[model samples]
Target: MPQSAQLTPEELVEVAQKISELLGGKVKFAVIGGAACSLVRVASDAEYRGTSDLDLVIQPNKSYNAEVISNWLVQKHPKIIRSVEQFGVRIPAIPIYRGKDEYLVEIEIFDVEAWPNRQQYNIADTASNPMTTLTFSPDQYSGSSGDWKIPVMHPVWLLREKILSQYEREGSVKERTDISDLQIMLQVVDPKSLVLSAHNHVTALQNLMAKRPDLINKLRRAIVCYPVFGD
Candidate 1:
C-alpha cells in the first residue's frame, strides 16, 4: 500500500519521537532515505522536501521483544497498522494514517538469520567526509525536538545509498530525482570519496549499471566537475 499524501517535517519528527519513546535507549536505530535527508535539511529546496515514508535501520538489542514493541505501537497509536513483507527476510513496516495524510516507517533489522555474517561499519570509518566524521561515531546519527531524539543516517552513506538507488532505477525520466539528489549531495560532500565508497561495493552497482548503460552517463555527468570519473 502507498500513501496518498506526504508528511511534513514536523509531523515526521512527531512519528519518530513516538517510535524513540517505544525503543527507548535499548534499541538502536539509524534512519536513511529521503526522510533522513529532510530531517537534516541536506537539500534545502522544495523538490527534496515532504518525503512519503521514513526509512530506518533498526539494530535491536539481543533481548529485543518484537511482540511487546508491536503491541505498544498499536496501543499508543491505534492508527498504526503493522505489516511484514519478505524480501529475503521479513521487513516490518508501519504505516500511520490520520485523516487525509499518511506516513510510513520502514525498519531494516540487523543480525538476522538470513544475513548470517553482518558487518557493522561506521560512516566516519568508511566514507571520507571530514566535517562530521572526526567527532561522529557509528550508528549514532540522531535528531531531536525538545526532549525526544531519533537517529538518522550519516550523510556520506546516505549519498552512497542515493547513488546506488539511481543506478538501480531505469529510465532517464524516472530517475531524475535520484540524479538530482546525487548532484545536490556532490555539491556539498566530496564526490571522489563518495564515488570511491560506492566502488567499494562495486559488485552490486556494476550489475545494475550493466543493464542501464545510459545511467552510467548520468552518474558521470553528476560528478563530472569532481576529481573522480564514474569509470
Candidate 2:
C-alpha cells in the first residue's frame, strides 16, 4: 500500500474554495472529519493533526442531486480532480493531486428526514444531524488567500462523531487519528457547551447509542476526562 500524506492548511482551504466555486452554490454542504478539525485548529491557533482527505456532508435540494454535482465537478475540473470513485450509493470520493502529494475530497449526500429509519452506521449522518457552520478566513491562516466562508461541523458534535468512529473502526488505520481528534476537541470545547450540544442532538445521539451500546462507556470516559473549572 502506498503511504498518503496530509494536505497543508493552506491547501485544504484552497481545495475547499475550489469545490465551493465549482458547485456554484447549487448545494448546501459543510466540512467534516479531519479537514474540519484542521479548519477549527487554524482558526483557533491550536496545533492540529494531519489528515489525508477532506470530508463534506451535503444536503442536495430537489433541483440538484448530489451524484450529479459530483459528476459535474469531475467533468468541469478534470485538471484538478484526478478521478472520482463512488462508494455504495451516495458517497463520491475525489482524489486531487498537487505536485508529489495527493489528497482526497469526499462528498456524502444525506437526508435525515428522508431516512429516519436507516440501518447501518453512518458517521456523516451523526456529524450533520444538528449541523453547525463556521466561517474561515483564509487570509488569517495563510496570507496568500482571501476570506472563505466555509461551513464546518461544530467541534462538540465532531467529538461525538469521532467517538463513534473510534469504536466502530477498532483496528482500522484511521482509528488512531479519530482518537487524537477527539482528545484535541475535548480540550478546546467548553463542558457546558458539550452538554448543550448533546441535549440539542439527543435524538441522534440516542439512535447512535442504540446502534452501538458498547460506545456508551467510551462516551462517558471522554466527557469525564474533560477539564472543568468551578467558581
Candidate 3:
C-alpha cells in the first residue's frame, strides 16, 4: 500500500490569504474556477477532488498596467515545474507534481473595474465603494485556504462569464468549458431565477435564449419561490 499527501480546502484558502497579505491586503477579489467551489465550499460536496491550484481575480487598487500585474503574479506563484504555453501561445503557469500526478498552480489577476464587465457583475455592496483590503486564517489541520465557505459568484454571475468568454475567445479550447458551464448554470436555475440572473446578462442571455427559448425559459420559471411555499 502507498500513502499520499494532499492539501485540503482550508490549505488552498491559506495560499490566497498569504498572497493577499504579501500584496498588502489589496485583494478584494472573488474566487473563481473549480478551486473556488472548494474554497467557498459551495458547489461540490466532494472535497477530495478539490486541490490542484489557486485561481484569483484581484480587484486592483488603481489603474492596472497588465504587464506589471502579470509579472507580479508570476513571481508570487509557488514554484515553477515548467514554463507555460497554451496552443503555442505562452501562458503564465507553474507545474507541481505529487506522487503519480502533476498539477499546475494558476494565478489570474483581474482589474476590479474591468474584469466582470457591465452585463455580468452584481455583487455591488454600496459602501462608498472604497478600495477593499483582505485577510485570511490559516488552519494547518483542515488544509483549506482563501474564502472557501461562501458562494464566490452568484449562480448567475457564472453564466455571464461563460457567455462573455464564448464571444471574446471564440473557437478557443476554453470555449468548450464555457459551454459546459452554461449548461450547469441552466441546471441550477429556473425562470424567475433566470430573469433575476439575466438582468445583468440580458445581452448575452437574449441571444442564447432566442435560439433555445423553450429550454431556457422552462428553466427560467422552474425555481419555486420559498416565501409562498405553503400557498
Candidate 4:
C-alpha cells in the first residue's frame, strides 16, 4: 500500500495533531523505522533520502479505548473502514482510502512493552544531538505529544527495531536504511546491546555489514561519531 502525496511540513504536523486529538493528549508514542529519520530530520540535505509511510508505536493508555476509538471513528469518519490483521497478535488497523489510494494506520496497541526498557538507554544516546529544531516541527501539532520537539527514536529502541526488521526482511533494500540507522544509533547508544538485539530478533537480512565486527571496525574510522548528552 504505497501511495504518494504532496504534503507540506505543516500538513504533516496537522496530521500528527489530528492523531494526537484522536488518541487523546500525547500519551507516549515513538516514530520509528523509516518514519523515524523522516521525522528526525537530523541528517543533512544529502543524507535525507529514504522516507516511508507513517507507522507509529503507541503507548496504550486509558484514553485509547479500543471500543471507544472504533466508535469515535465510525461517528466521525464517513470514508474509512476498520479491519484487523493477524501479525503474531490480534492487531487492528484502520484504512482511510481515498480514491484508489489507501493510507494504512496499524496499531499494535500494547502497554509497557519495550518503550520503558529502552527509554533510558535511548534517552542517554539520543541526548547527544543538541539540534532540536528540524526541518519538520513536531511541536507544531494540534494536540499534545508530551514534550517532544522533533519526532525522535531512542538509540537502543530504534536499534532494536532495525535489528528486528533486518531479520524479517533479509533481502530488502530497506536493509540499507536499517544499516545506516544503526550506524547513527551506535554513535551514542551501547554498541554491544545493538549487536545483541540485532542478532536476536533480526532474522531478515542475510548479511548486515553492521553485524560484521570487522566491517563495523572499518565504519568507526569513516562515520564521524559526535556523541551528545540530554536529560
The top-ranked prediction according to lDDT is 2
Candidate 3: clashing residue pairs, number: 22
After best superposition, candidate 3 residue 140: deviation in angstroms?
12
Tens digits of per-residue lDDT, candidate 3, 1-231, equal 122234555546555554444444434555565554344332332323354555555545464333345565566553532335545643354443456775555545444455545423223442212122223343443455543232255544454466656555567776655655666655554445422233434455454555445645443454332321211
lDDT of 4 by residue, 1-231 (tens): 433453334444444444444555535544555655544434322244344234455444567533444445445653543444445444434454457776555433323334455433233234431112223334554354455343445555565566456656657887666766665655555434333323344232224544565555533433333220110
- The window of 10 residues in a row where model 3 has the poorest summed lDDT is 126-135
lDDT of model number 1: 0.51
Q: Write the per-residue lDDT of candidate 2 for residues 95-207, one digit (tens) a residue.
A: 55667765566555443334445311233564335455556776655565656777777777778677667666767888777767776676666654444243323544454
Tens digit of per-residue lDDT, candidate 1, span 25-88: 7555565567666655522433445565555444434565444444444555555545455465
CA deviation > 4 Å runs, candidate 3: 1-24, 33-42, 45-55, 62-95, 100-102, 112-151, 167-175, 187-203, 210-214, 222-231
What would the TM-scores of all predictions be?
Answer: 0.57, 0.65, 0.50, 0.50
Question: Which of candidates 2 and 3 is the stronger one according to TM-score?
Answer: 2
What RMSD, rounded to one decimal, does every model reach?
7.4, 7.0, 8.1, 8.2
Measured by C-alpha RMSD in angstroms, how accurate is candidate 3?
8.1
